[model samples]
Target: MRTQTLLTAMLIGMATPAALAGPAADFRAADANGNRQLEFDEFRVFVDLRANGGNAQAKKVRLFKAYRLALGKVDYDGDGIVTGDELIRFDRANGKS
Candidate 1:
């Protein structure tokens, strides 16, 4: 548990805030179900939170696009869920984070 915490902190700390474009905290916040993994709905909520919208409707639109793109990029096993490990691997593989 200690090691996992340390590793999470290390990974979070290693990425500069700017590089992540607000996603580090966003990812944590997105885990809304508290399951330590992101369901599609939770991920949609997260992407919605991170998206910029001129108004509520615009935000929803942006969120939908972002969610679709993010789902494609992160859901590696097509299991319809995303784990932190999967997220990390996706980011690393894509030259992100």
Candidate 2:
């Protein structure tokens, strides 16, 4: 019985982070129309800014490019999209949530 209690506590402790892992605001961005979809054009705007001599925007452009790649990898359902649910799951799996 003591061993059982200890095991249960351990399991709960290990599971706590997963349970608490939910969507976060920073993991998302707004699109042109102010909708929250990870679209290509939103990313391109950053690139365009940099091309126009916005060095600060270049940094953001690179960051978003990396994010886009990472998000694409997580979009397993392949609806050519990554919804909030998908983002949450990806973050939880990566321990970022």
Error of 1 at 50 (Å): 2.4
- Kindly list the per-residue Cα lDDT of model 1 for residues 1-97, writing each as its tens digit: 6543333332332222234656556667778867777798877665565554122432543534545545655678988887767777754664566
Task: Give the distance in Å from residue 2's predicted Cα in candidate 1 to where it truly belongs.
Answer: 43
Off by over 4 Å in 1: 1-22, 52-66
Q: Relative to the unseen true structure, what is the C-alpha lDDT of residue 60 in candidate 2, on a scale of 0 to 100? A: 39
For candidate 2, lDDT tens digit of each residue in 31-85?
A: 4555555455543442343334433423433544543543354465876555556
Candidate 1: C-alpha lDDT: 0.56
Candidate that scores best on TM-score:
1
TM-scores of the models, in the given order?
0.56, 0.40
- Please give the RMSD of candidate 1 to the true structure: 11.7
Q: How many steric clashes between backbone atoms does each model show?
A: 0, 0
Lowest lDDT sum, 10 consecutive residues, model 2, at: 9-18
Question: Which pairs clash in the backbone of model 2?
Answer: none
Give the Cα error of residue 38 in candidate 2, in Å.
Answer: 2.5
